[model samples]
Target: MSTTGAPPRPGPRPQGPQDAGYGYDVERLDPRGPGRMGAAGPQRRRRRRPWARWALFGLSFLALAGGAVLLYVFVILPLGFGTSLVAFTAALLPVAIVLGAVWWVDRYTPQPRVSLIYAFIWGAVGSVALTFVIGTPFTAWISPSEPDQVTAQFLGAAIQAPVVEETMKSAGLIGLLIWGRRYIAGPIDGVVYAALIAGGFAFTENILYFGNSFHQAQAAGEVAGFWQTFFLRGVLSPFAHASFTALCGLGLGIAAERRSLMLYFGLGVGGLSLGMILHALWNGSSFFLPVDPANPLGGFLRYYLTVQVPIFLILVAIVLFLRWRERRILRRQLAEYGRAGWFAPAEVDMLVKLGARRKAEKWASRHGAVARMGMRDLIRATVELGMERHSVLHGKPSERTRRRERELLERITTDRRLIGALTAPVVRR
Candidate 1:
């Protein structure tokens, strides 16, 4: 990482293009160097167009308004008295837990907070609102006859719900890839954003399901319905939406780096299709066997054992693999930058290991709160700089990327100086 201390000595530049074997052109490695690929000076910043600013504002307002309306319709209107309170309280535990898990998995490089919030809002409000609009009429058209209500329910769950809900949910991720391309650097980022969006959608959906379950149970003089639904949705399958949408996220995340239009389209379509299939299978599981009211959770337990558990295990394996990939990429990219004199070898080692990073933060805390915070920012900026460098090497390099690289380098320098000044006395003593 760049620091206020003397910069590392630059290695000998490759003598020829053929000698540049670190996957990036040797000539274009340093933006500040005097070479064919070097910037003559800083690029001028462009002012944002008024229409673009207004569009973002309009979208934000719509998201907030829609979320408020849904909260009222789904939670408040349907469940009066204390039911709404109980439902929201029960629903939030799983959402928080799942969100924390996703956030933790993104340890290598955290995403922009604004992008994460946008994704969650899009899923919770925009996706749900659109789903309600499109699904209600479609489901109504396929509503079963009086004698075949069970068949209609099955069709709605297996076919209609998956098609509509998965598509709507995946749309949020798609939009993120289009509008916030820089936020998603790899598969792990894709998973993180997908999980957040999915968690938000599940939270809203659970409010409706749990609230209705509670209301019906109270009417029938049984309180078990609420707890049972809670256990199933909240405890057992909180990651249902997340796992489904992760497939789509993985596709779009990979697509972001691709130059071929065909490959991008293929991956995007394949991912969305896979997510829909998984969702359909999950929803359709209820039709495979009969449920005994006496054994209220018998059917669900069987499905959970046979279906949900295996899928969840698979998702866990995939997540672990992706996390490992992210770490490897960080190490590889940062090592390249280190050799190119953007970071010292010791700094690359510290940045690559979570243990080392945590220890650095702990040491900084002994100096003061500000030192600790500065260390954290320095670490994050280092990782982000590595990712940007990786993008430049593997994908097409652009002027914007060169500018971001310069900005990140400057941030690392500032943060390092702040933390060093704060901790200097402690270190000397």
Candidate 2:
């Protein structure tokens, strides 16, 4: 972990670096090696070929670009830009809703914005493109020579769609786990990232469905089909994809904590399988449910109420539990620093409690913009510090983590000085 010179004490100032008058040695707080750079620092050297990594990056960029081109040509061009624009506009509603839900869950220890954007783009573009490439052939291979429309739709939605789409979406989660492992501390982070990717996928998929419906309805001189599709997908089941993929994220998050490769793979595969099963179940239900000619959605509504609603509720409860676990970890980890005099107990309470933190920010905002910015930085650094300490307490310690801790502590120190308006929050019990 990182430690810095404590704030000035009431008595005389400490004489040396080791004795900053906190009653504890700053060096002792961080058992890791010092990062002080002397005058004669080592010179930078150019590295030799990192060809494999660069090749992978290039290939990925090319693949996504190709996918975008295919999407524009095959999907968007067929619908025409005007129709696609209308679909895109309608799709934004559900995207905003999912994003808001993810943001609320990710309020504590938020992941990097760049990483979140990558996940979203991969879900929207890369996964959709992969689905086009793999799903078309696979569906053709499985379909009978003389296929009926109903059978083909069932095969595509219940079997092929679930298998293909979930696999493609899960790939984004796997990539994040492999490349952005440091950002994923636990299941909450996994769920949040997975939800973002699923959200993006849902957004793109909605545009296609919405566009198709609108075009068909326009040709028939009726808006019923388009409105019906929107009601089903947009109003009722906006989070369906997110719910399914979050299972995979939950698994990958648990996988992140494990050192064993087999265990990690096992858990990840398990989560993906669960997500696929739920997706298939959801898609297949429409087929099994009896549809009345007068009331088309009678059975569908019953299934949604009985099955899908419960599953969504259970997922919500699990997320709440995970968030509570995060709060517990923050309290446990920061309490050690609080005891060491690096943080006041009230400050720790403020960091863990969103209500208290909000109040503090509101207070800082009354002072000035600088004070507001400083308060935000202070809260963020404090959260990161707790997470860093938690990482060290677990078996994943490294020098890089220590360096990050030092950097975060330095940030916290600077922010605390700037945020002089709010020292310790008067948190409610």
Candidate 3:
């Protein structure tokens, strides 16, 4: 039940290296005396190699193109123009809701827009495209010789779909972790990116389901079927995919923090495996429910209430805890900067709380656009600075990290100067 804005209580001073789950000695950090980084002196800017960026951009383009082709062939051709359009519009509602929640969770330490977009595209287009490429043929090959339609559908939904879809989605996570390493500062970042990808996948998948249901209902003269499908998928279980994928993201995030290659693989596999299992169980539940003539959906409804609802609630709790943990990290790390004179204690307090940060930004708006923009950038950079320090303290205490620290310090200094100059007292001679 930790809250984002609750002020951190004072704790015992660090006695040695073991503190905050890292090896770094918080005591050893130099204050803002002469020749210290707290002064934010000029430093050399390092130029990042562009190959990863270019390669990622190129791959995203191909995936998007391929996805468009698949969309036209599979969804549009089968469902017709009007139905597809309706499905597309209907599909947007849940996607928007899920994406908004993810975005809100990520607000503490906002990631780069480009990276977020890449994650979404990978989920929406790349994963779906790959699933189509592999799933159709593989499913056909594995089809049982005994022609039991219900059994076949159950196998496809419970077995093939989970394995194929989660794997394809995980590929995107792996790519992001490899090429866009800087974007994922911790577990929350991992969740944010993973959820975005899931949101994208769900969007396209929903379109197919809704379109098919719409057309099928029309043909069967049972228009209620489409609405029922919408209620079940759209309202009742929109976040199902996101919850599953977030476990993988959580693993990736922990691995990123630990800076262990083995963990990157081990945890990634472990998380993906867990996700697949959960997905399978979720899909399999409906197939195995005992038929009750009195209440046809009694079993499914009970399972949804007892199993699905609790899982979703638990995931929501975990996300909230993680966000609160993020706030704590910012407060702890920024307190050290405060002691070093890089920031005031009041400023540190303002930066960690969402409400205070918003008020500060709003207050700055009265001074004009530059001040407001400077405030926003300063908040973002300050959060980044704290996260970078957290990353260093975790396991990556390399020279590159040191360089990033200096860069952030300089950027913060420049922002402070810009904002200060705007409100500084003018002297008239």
Candidate 4:
């Protein structure tokens, strides 16, 4: 076997646009590229006391919840918690929904829960905390001289918020993508992390907006300002966080997978800058410009959110569909590996889809708990083995997880040996 658990001589069998079972020839038809779908071994099962994992999960959850609340109250809330409660609540609700959706959907793969929490912390910590260090003086210097005029707000919102805010918020994902690479798979993973960061920033920001709006309305004895902020910040474009952090994730995904020289740095910095620019534009664009509200080009809110929002949704859908398609590709390529005497056909079928594996596990349970555990191991090994063999067929370079394929293969080989030695096959002749 070649290094990293993949067979060296076989080369990579790149998956293309096709359904599963194009036969073993799928390996022969793959096109080579910089972005190879390298394989990852399923998390190995360690037979320890069950409470160990539970304890770790509890500690991580506490850290995430406690950290965000602390940073918000002492740091962000002090700065602007009295700003706008309504807007804050509105913004906060949707973000919580999105995060909940991602967490629920990605149950098959054990996501890096810690990294996500850290990403959110990075947004809140960097946006408000670092802003105090770098932006406070600038704000102090500028606010006193200006008349709190439209010009001043424009400069602060458009110029400072976009550049400083996106950079600060995105830093968490960038750092994680670089340091905690083993946890990150690609752009979709990046989106999940960066979006969490963006959501946190939005949450803290909404506190200020909401509190301020409440006081402003109470003073005027009118809710127009509250409604305006709600519509502008909330309904007009609820996806502001998703947009800003998405670029960062795209960059991280490209860098993590691609094998280009400039691409690594280019993707990271370029994506961050892009996110900042978009944020800046959102800040700069005015809701009530000189033009009539009824006019075609009256406001950017009409153009950006209305026109661009649907486009962004479409793009997200496309990317998700591609990932799903890729999974199907892997299933087919791996099914071929089942024929090579490396793994059993039943094991391969179990991993072809999530539901099928659960069914097989139930069947194994009929024998005993040990057999069920062994079946699970067999399922994971077969899945990983197919991934390695596909890489071999396609000639892709080694990735972070691909590096461990060998250890996985060794376990699988050992398991196969155990099967042969432990149970005798009846002779048909």
Candidate 5:
């Protein structure tokens, strides 16, 4: 919007009389008035926001994306080749899809594009590269050193993997906050972003593991172990990254939001340490301190997720409750702005409830698709605009912030008028 300068205006000139001088009033410029100022200079080129600053996102995506492909091709392909590639691909589908969705959602805001791109790269590339180098030896060292042959595999499966994998998986989330500080928000964002990266890593890794399972089945001359492991990894473990990464995210998020530097560091570091402990406990849960000499740990592989699953669920419950609280706080904040006449009471009510918002959009849809979409946008924009108003009440918003808010509401509310409906007129001065 600042790309164009308004047209110059003529001012009245005054000559002083001997006895008294008269002051002249010059009309102030009206930005929206149809004329040179409105239509000619700033409007023609209509420069977009400094979205150009984020154009680098495209390049980051390309560079990191190629790396993901190469890793998958060389590492994952070999692992799956011995068995059935189809099973690997099938198991990978959900993880891959969820990762992409998370990536897309993070883009909706003017977030630090590099931070997000790095998050993906850190997980898919950095974390993977670390684990491949670190995990191979742990496997070899532990392989022959199991409990009674009956429980040896469980020790390697439970204790070995969690200690090995969770540390590797958590590195990306930590790297993101340390190196890419611009994008990290509260615990919620930390979880979501970390989970995305972890999920992406897990998905790619799962394909390889599943593929190897198939290959091992071929070696054993068994058909069922491949599918059974495939089902377990594909269905059960795709969400594992999301769960584990969320713990780290929660820690980073708490630290990010804290005003006190000491407290922030302490809380965040504590949370991350807790996450590591959780990972160890989860991995080792399969074999508790063994009561039987035949079993190194008591429970074995069956309890790895089962033990951690409840903790993950509790974390999820806490996250949901926190999110609901945020939504309600936002709703209450916006409803107060309705008192200023910018929004109608009905509109505020609809914005506060998901169901009310949906019904309002559905009602608007009978007129036209564009109208319905516009109304939906209007409601959302109004809520956001009201929030911006609160920020403005406290301090001056930059021109870009103001322009963006105006543009969003204009696009939405304008469509509502064109559809022969008006939700509410602008508030009176």
Candidate 6:
């Protein structure tokens, strides 16, 4: 009788290019033959696409055009009011604060500087311009000839502005998901990108609001309007747009790491919807629960203590959870790569913990800046390799994925060699 036992262990399966050792020599295993570039050949060609440069040029032109329009409206037009300096200064201070917070949060694995700047420009110029264009006509059309102040304000704040502004701000995140998907590794990336966009949007919006407040205050012969507006928009609610857009960013980030089209679409829609709803609630609060105009500060305290403060705390909790998840991902994926021999087990331990990573940087700093930078690059490449592997296993791997994997391995080797060479002299001395 034919035996049903497991066939005598077959000869070891032939190692393909990917199964080759994680060293520079692994290129010899390329299925395209020893001299050919293999998976990276097509990626190099794709990177040279002529359309990308043109697209970048188009975006730059749009940003410049939008900025010109906004400058006319917010700065030049309001010049006669005599508060241009105060308005610009007030607008920028909060932006600086928000940017500092964002940079600190993204210290572990910062996204590309160019991508971050693009997000900010999209929010500041493109989104703001689009919103102003659409919202002005819509609001004007909806207003009654003899408008009631309460109803007009309620509709504009609760319905019109939230819908228009959130939609416009989210366009930037959507663009990133489409064109720069690789940059968003997790929810934290999304939050960072969203925060940059929100900061930019707030910057431009503040310029307009502050300028208007200055003009109105001068017309009424009172300086208090400018300060009151600054206190509310600049100090108290500068992060309002960021917090709202972060919900959308969180959704996009989750979707980027997933493979299912339905899940992606659902998360994107849900995130945008949630942001709009929260924005509406915040804006509508002023109308439903009218603050006593006589005691504006007291009313603001009451409203903030009850509503905005709680929402801010919730956002803080979400950020902490996302940061924890980032650490967990780094640990789990690097451990798997360690087993596969891509990383030393000890190296994985150092890379996974923030304290260990910092210690490593300090050690490298003693060698020289070149060694320090090499150490940093090695750590980043190793982390990226782990993330790429995780993404491939969880979703569908692409040609770009293979190329990236190969590039990261090469980078890790080069960086390590550089660091070793730099430290070798110190050790001998």
- Each prediction's Cα lDDT score? 0.77, 0.80, 0.82, 0.60, 0.58, 0.77
User: Which 10 consecutive positions of candidate 3 have the poorest summed lDDT?
Assistant: 17-26
User: Model 5 over residues 379-399: C-alpha lDDT tens digits?
Assistant: 656655544443344344445
Mark the regions of model 5 whose C-alpha exceeds 4 Å error after superposition: 1-53, 80-84, 93-126, 133-186, 235-238, 255-264, 286-298, 301-306, 364-369, 379-429
State the TM-score for model 3.
0.86
Give the higher-lDDT candidate: 1 or 5: 1
lDDT by residue (tens digit), candidate 2, 253-332 = 87665534675688788989999999999999988999999999888999999999999999999999989988998898
Which digits, one per residue and each the tens of the lDDT, describe model 6 over residues 1-429? 559987786553443332222232212222422112234554343455858855974776576577758766764565654566667777998898889888977877667777888888888888887887899777777787877888788778888899899999988887777775676766788889999988998998888888788878989999898898988898888789999999988888787767557866898789889999999988887765656668867866788888889998999899988877777878887766555455656678888777888988898898889888988888888777766566666776666667767878778888866776676544331
Off by over 4 Å in 4: 1-70, 73-91, 104-110, 137-148, 259-261, 287-301, 304-306, 342-349, 352-403, 410-429
Ranking by TM-score: 3, 1, 2, 6, 4, 5
lDDT score, candidate 4: 0.60
What would you estimate as the lDDT of candidate 3?
0.82
Candidate 3: deviation at residue 262, Å? Answer: 1.7
What is the model-wide C-alpha lDDT for candidate 1? 0.77
The local distance difference test score of model 2 is: 0.80
Q: Per-residue alpha-carbon lDDT of model 4 for 184-241, expressed as tens digits?
A: 5555566667777777777667666766776788789998877777666665555676
Off by over 4 Å in 2: 1-66, 144-148, 258-260, 365-371, 417-429
Which model scores highest in lDDT?
Answer: 3
Choose the strongest candidate by TM-score. Answer: 3
Predicted candidate 5: what Cα RMSD to the true structure?
Answer: 12.5
What is the TM-score (0 to 1) of candidate 5?
0.63
What's model 2's lDDT at 93?
Answer: 91
| Candidate 3 Cα outliers beyond 4 Å, as residue runs | 1-47, 50-55, 140-147, 425-429
- Cα lDDT over the full model 6: 0.77
Tens digit of lDDT per residue, candidate 1, span 1-429? 676898888865443321122112232355443122246386678764758845874787576677769768764676786777777888898898888898888766788777788878777777787887888788877675452778778878988888888888888877776665677766778788888888888988888788788888889999887788888899988899999888888877776655345756898788889988999988888777688978857877887898789988998998998788778888988776666666656778888899999988898898889988988998999888776676566666677777778778778778867875675544321
